[model samples]
Target: MLARLGAISLSLSMILLLSMNYGSFALVGFLSATGLIALVVLHPWTARLTDRHGQGKVTAAAAGIAALSYAAFLACAHWKAPAWTLFPAYALAMGSSPNVSGMVRRRWAHLHDGSTRRAANAVEQVADELCFLSGPILATILVTSVFPEAGVLASGVLLVTGMLLFAGQRRTEPPADPAAGRRESSPLRRPSVWAVLMPYALVGILFGALDVTTVKHTTSMDSRSAAGVLLSMIALGSAISGLAFGKVRPRSEPRVPFIVSVAALAVLTCVPLAAARLLPDSLPAIGAAMFAVGIGTAPVIILGTSIVQACVPEARLNEALVWPSSAITGGNATGNALTGWIVDHAGDSSGYWVPVVVGPAALLAAYAGLALHRRTDDDCVAAEDVGV
Candidate 1:
């Protein structure tokens, strides 16, 4: 129940906050990038707090703060606040965004050991995919069909409610570990961790490009009204994969699925490019292509995350999880900047190719990371075998 509420809260908040007047896509992108950087910098600290105090307390506090930020955004919209003021406010809100998915996975790890843990992780992944799939669609309906600010209002309510509920979940809190809480591993010293993080960073770039591509394509097709529907399709695809993964028996070779998923993503990214040629001028065609892309996305994320969790130490799990999340944020920033520039100069048609190029690059990076990760430790297991 708490997990459901938490997901609803985040979904509501993102739909409300992001769907607002994005006067300058470039500015919004830059601000988002800054916000992601802030999250990255603060993630380890937040994780440390969770480790020491409890995941519930930290998550609730973060969600509550996030709720206030959404409320502030509602105020800004009402008053027609200047960009200067709004940007900082939005940045602060984004920076403080809860790493809810990571926290949930950590709890799953805590609840189950060995194979059971992997199954739990898979369930969590499915939950995340379902949230992503549903959250935006609901938010979009409320914002577009009802009122622009309705999304924000809904988000604020959900955040406060969800976080409070999540905090109350007996199973959600991290186990008390004074020693683990006090222990610190200098991020700078871990070259092995960096190797895994680099590819994940590339994946983040893909995320950013994808975000811009989706928005630009939908707007260009004059189907901005259906943007949420398009995004939901993608999320649905992921949720399906996650559910299937959870029920499957563990595999001995996790990298195989990871590599296969990235390769599929690379192929799927070309859908946009293909749409440009095949449909040439059809909005429906573009939407169809996007749905296809969504079909290929979920397994990649779920498997990639599972591998990362399996590879990292239990003690450093939260910190390790933050790297991937930060990489995603960094990618978003880069994609937004690049996409914004392309849209400004070239036209929306050119924007379609960005993911086509980035996807392949990400595939290569993922393969390299997998190879390197395999060389590190004796107990380092494959993602499939670990059921991650």
Candidate 2:
């Protein structure tokens, strides 16, 4: 989760930093686009590497590269280097980011199965929500209160530090399954895997768009500092619900909760529009709406992660789970670039429309998955078909 802090914190910090320093959301978005491309391109290779080598050795190597990348990015920012230089440097940093969050889930899955796994997934979701809850607030506060460079610097520090610490936790690492290396069935080739991943890709877009838009929206009102707090409200809502969700037992198929949460998220996204229309100018009102919209975020995430864990075999868990993480970061990259440009050309208010539009698209993907796979409630049973 520390790596997540670095990633998300960097995103929030960089979006504001690049836009404020460069005064070009289009440029910022373009930079984010490069990152999105790099992440997607490297997805399979990274997953395979983790599968073959264990998480610790791979993560340590990645952490070293990431440290160098962060230094390069900071140097560029400090010197006001040519815009062209930021793209590769930032992409390297983003692309090399270790998936410690995914590793944590792997650890939990290693220890538990059945109803217990659900609880662990719920806790993992809560940890994620907490990161979201704290990441922006910590990042922005540092940037706003300390030095303009402080947020990115702090994010980099947390990322490197968190990763090294996690890498050292060798005891909890999943046993290196030798057969996993020889497995022919890639998670990408599975229809059931894609069934869950597709809707999540849109969900990633929703999260990314929401971040860029919220910052732009609050910044427009001269309450730029309030951006972190309003953003935290969204995480706060999710964290609260995540806690409650952990206690309940599943009553239906995994897809049922998946669809319900997506639908709720799609519908609650409207709360922001309604809040804006009614109050027209209150930051508090927008904060309230953001919190409500966040309510649906965790349930969808918790259920989605649980679904992936259940469907994929233990050997391929890393390969399969990485896709959802990829979707989020890749989607975030897409959201940042797209919404940043929309805010630049159209108007700040236009950024708000992104989530409203993307939310239902996620719901559609969820329903489509429902029809396509129709997997039973026994989705918890592992499917090992692909390793032919």
Candidate 3:
């Protein structure tokens, strides 16, 4: 998940900047969108590979492909190569991401059960928050202190080293499942899978828009430097809550936690808008709102993923896990593009509404999942009962 953050947050701006240098801002947007699209399109393939070949081998191979893509990127930047090469380089690299978060969650499911798995998920969520909180800062420092390509290079190295080390932990790896290949049909056909995925995509939109909107909002207040700081506070709040959440065993099934967390998230997501309206000049107020939003975010993810772990077939676990992330990527891209437009025309303050509107969409998705779970209660058992 930490490594995934580097790709999502760190190398992202670097890729955009490199693309912009190659051609126009249109190229930048195009590549960024294409990279995300490629992730959605190619992610299922990686899941299939992971399930069939084992996580270690697939991850190692994917990291290698990503490394080579970065190498191509470096060569292009060095020689000032054609701008078009950037497309393939980025597509190949992002397409080869290996769904690190999904793999980690799968392992957690493999090793733990019930409240322990929930606790483990919480721990992973905390790690995820820390990664987002620290990864971008690290990348920014490296880029500014070293070179333009420094962040990408560092990420590439980390990708290789980290995946290699992670892959080496054979005892922790999930065994290859032959059943994953039995059905050439995708997991998208499963209503249970899509129920979780649809809302997650909505949540992803909230995430992506929240990011771009925060930057715009901070810049509008002439405190652009505090944007990252404010965002870090948000992540900090989530990490703290994640720790607390892990310790307490929820009295209900995963669905209840999922619904409540998302409902809280939907409401808390509006706080930023209120802050923007009421204290237009106060970045701190906006930060406070972001912190609240963060608090709700982790539990939603933790419970949602726990439910997904329980709901999907063990053989198709990798594919099931990747769907939510893919939906997130797709939704994030949608939110960024849409909010960017809103920020340009409607104004920065209006950008907050993007998340506001999308938050309920996420809630609706959660409710859909709950409804589906009610209808097919037997299908949605505890993770331990599923015995993946």
lDDT of candidates 1 onward, in order: 0.66, 0.80, 0.75
Residues 1-388, model 3: lDDT tens digits: 5465666454344433453356343344456666778898898888988998899888777777878887886677657678787778777777877788788988988887766777788888898888777765666556545776777777777776677777777998889976677854566766667767878889888877776677667667766456666777668888988898888777666666777888998999899899999998998898899889889888877777777788776778888888888998888767766776677667877888988888888888889877876777665675445321
Question: lDDT tens digits, residues 122-216, model 2?
Answer: 88888888998898899789878887778889889999988888889999898766578576577676666777788888877776777777787
Worst 10 residues of 1 by lDDT: 6-15
> Which model is ahead, 1 or 3, in terms of lDDT?
3
- What digit string (tens of lDDT, one per residue) describes model 1 on residues 268-369? 878877986787667677667767776777676666666666666677676667777777767766776777667657776677778888888888887787
Judge candidate 3 against the unseen true structure and give its global Cα lDDT, from 0 to 1: 0.75
Supply the global lDDT for candidate 1. Answer: 0.66
Error of 2 at 126 (Å): 0.6
Off by more than 4 A, model 2: 375-388
Model 1 bad stretches (over 4 Å): 1-22, 181-192, 379-385
Which window of 10 residues has the lowest lDDT sum in candidate 2? Answer: 379-388
After superposing all C-alphas onto the true structure, candidate 1 shows an RMSD in angstroms of 3.0
Candidate 2 lDDT at 99 equals: 68
Residue 249, model 2, lDDT = 72
Better of 2 and 3 by lDDT: 2
TM-scores for all candidates?
Answer: 0.87, 0.94, 0.88
